[model samples]
Target: MENFKIDVDADGIALITFDVPGRSMNTLTSGVMAEIPQVVERIKTDDAIKGAVLTSGKASGFCAGADLGDMAGGMLAGGSLQEAYDAGWKLNGALRALETCGKPVAAAINGLALGGGLELTLACHYRVVGDSAKIQLGLPEIKVGLFPGGGGTQRLTRLIGVQAAMTAMTAGSSWRPNDAKGAGVVHEVVAAGTEVEAAKAWIKGGGKAVQPWDDKGFKQPGGGPYHPVGIQNFLVGNAMIRKQTYGNYPAATNLMKAVYEGIQVPMDAALRIETRYFIKTLMTPQAQAMIRSLFLSKQELDKGAVRPAGIPQSDPKKVTVIGAGMMGAGIAYVQALAGIETILIDRSQEDADKGKAHVEALLKKRLSRGQLTQEKYDALLASVTATTDYDLIKGSDLVIEAVFENREIKADVTKRAEAQLEGGAVFGSNTSTLPITGLAEASVRPEDFIGIHFFSPVDKMMLVEIILGEKTGEAAIAKSLDYVMKIKKTPIVVNDGRGFYTSRCFGTYVAEGLAMLEEGYAPALIDNLGRATGMPRGPLEMHDDVALDLSVKIAK
Candidate 1:
């Protein structure tokens, strides 16, 4: 009751708003699960209530899914696997009861409805989502080494086709409202403020109380896994899983099993099947480690848990990128995409214009794909000024040097760029190898010098490693984190060192492979083992990706 508020209108529509007090987002905890059955009972018994609508009071999203703290607590409490399995049933049971309570229910999803949140919407007979581009809906539990336990594996497959469902859940893919609707996960996507009314409208329009799979003579979208079409999907899907996961993720394998096995049975039994697989995954050490690193630690870092609280949050209005090569061009494009005025500077107008052309090419591709409006593309392109002028960086709040990775060149650009930066402006070196403290030696304001290492194909890569020099101040770290967030990239803070974090660790993989070759291992065997181990690329392919010549130089 504390987490949920119920109100019944004269039209016999009960609106149950999920608003976890003192929390910015709602999550399915044991307390929330325990409360759901009581609401289900109320909906079923109350003669005046004909149907119900479920929604969130939080502005940020509907729900973030399961409370990780509570989940990890249950799993790590020195309990038996059966105990963990039993605990999962408590949640699975509540969602099941809600679905089959003989009363219609509709979900009014205003924003993100991920993992258990998406599962909750699936349990409803109808779903109405706000037409907000930011709304993220997915069963992303697989990312944390667990599959959906609360009927997600069963219900999603039954709602959408099996192949589509498997792909979405396995990939931890999130979708916008329209995409969710297209996937048959949602019934309607209305204007932003009208989601709640739309849900009420669906229920008032005779929304069914039973799922299609539960109704008499109902058939699954693509028959059961044994059907010819189903066979092809599952066979290829199994091969795909082995190739993609390289059998590294137990959750992915079990999730496919749950969907494959569950769809052949009745709804109730399918839910039980999913819970069994879910608990199997929950008990693995891989799940625990992933939950900590990928979920808990990442969440803490994303919220700026280590940022100095004394320093005000940074909002970088303008940015400057030195050098017009691929890295520098990417930095400028992302800055412009974030609505920041960006200066893309190089040695000549032609070189800088090439960098601008890269941005234009990317914008054109996006426009062709309907990901960007022509007007928006023009504005973003206009925000970036490509030139050779150094004085133009005078107003930049952040100047990131993405020139060649030579110490002398970097030091030279550092002095020239820093001279143009305004008072309080932060300077960053985007070098993957050279130490930030060493780079800071050339800067007049060493306190403002920081390393902001971005990966290749910067627009696609999500991680941005922020290396703090010995002289780097908290304000510099804070501002760099802000700029990384502005570009929608994940930031991991580390001390200044050669190849800071990702690069330092990644280099070892190739080195180890090359070492194996020295030990008389066949080159083909080494590359095959690397790919089969779920690495992004084979050892040789990765070596080629970093460029063989560069790889040899780095190895030395």
Candidate 2:
């Protein structure tokens, strides 16, 4: 009741709004989960209520899915498989009961709906959504090493084709509003405010409560896993999973199993089978670690949990990035995109211009893919002032040097930029090696000196390691964290060290590949085996990605 508010209109349509108290976004917390069944029961028993419309009160999105801070509480951590199964099955039962409650239930999805949120929409007999590209809808639980247990595997496959469902769920893909409707998952797409009206209108216009799977002689799309066409797809799908996951991720394989098996049965029985696989997937230690790191820990870091509370959040009005190569150019691109005036400097006018050119190249790729409007692309491109003028640092609140991994070059850029920089402004060295404390020696404001390490292909990489020099004050740290957050990259604060945090961790991984090479193994074999372990790239390939020159500098 606290998480949901229900109002029955004069036309006998119950509007159920999911609004979790004291939260900016709605999540399936224990209170909200508990109320789902209660609401379904109310819809079933109340004679005056002809149907219901479900929606979220939060503007940021519908539900962000399970509150993993709760570790999904009973669904994964109850000390036994039976306990986890029982807990998950309860919600599945509630969702199933609602769809079969003998009255049409329509979901008025206003914004993002992921994982259980998407599953909730699927359980409804009809779904009407607002037309917004920002509004994403999909089941993305596979990212945190868990598969959907809320009838997602069963229902989505039955609703769409099995092959499409497998691809979406396994990739943890999300889609825009129109894409959802095109995929046959959503019934209607309307203007933003009219989504709720459309949902209510559907039920009033005689929408049926019965699901496709529950209908007599209903057939699943693309047939079951054993059909002639389905058999080839599953055969190919199993091979794809092995290649993609390298047999390391069980959740991906089990999800395929759940869909494969559940697609053949009735809705109720399929829900039970999905729950069983969900429990089996949850029992893995890999899932536990992934949930903690990829979900819980990532959520905390992404929200700036380590940022200094005493200091007010402030993003730099202007940021200067030196070096126009991949890292520097990428940093400037993101900063400019975040609406921060960016100055990209290098040794020459030609070098600085190349940085802006790189931004243009990336923008063009996005434009060709229809990810950016040409006007927006031009505006972003114009925001970066690519030049050789160190004088431009005069008004920059933050100056990041992303040159090579040489101390002298780093020190030179630091001192040159510092001469033009105003008082108390932060200086960030984007070096993976060379301690920040040592680099701070060139700065008049050592307290304002910090390391802002960015990975290669900076636009794609999410992590930004903020290395604290011995004299780096909270203001510099806070400033760096704020800027990182503003740019929408994950930031992790670490004390100064040679090859701090990420580099240190990656060094160990790359070391094994080198060891194999030293043991007379072929470089290609080392890389192939390394990649099979689910690394983004093979060890040698990663070294090349970070640049062989930078790798050598780090080693030295």
TM-score of each: 0.92, 0.94
Q: Considering summed lDDT, which 10 consecutive residues are worst modelled in model 2?
A: 69-78
- Residues 136-185 of candidate 1: C-alpha lDDT, one tens digit per residue: 89999888999888898988888888889898989999888889889889
Please report, in order, the local distance difference test score of every candidate based on alpha carbons.
Answer: 0.88, 0.89
Which candidate gets the maximum TM-score versus the true structure?
2
Candidate 2 regions with alpha-carbon error over 4 angstroms = 360-382, 544-550, 553-556
Model 2 TM-score, all chains together: 0.94
Model 2 agreement with the true structure over 384-477: per-residue lDDT tens digits:
9999988888899999999877888888998899999888788999988789999999888899999999987899999999999999999999
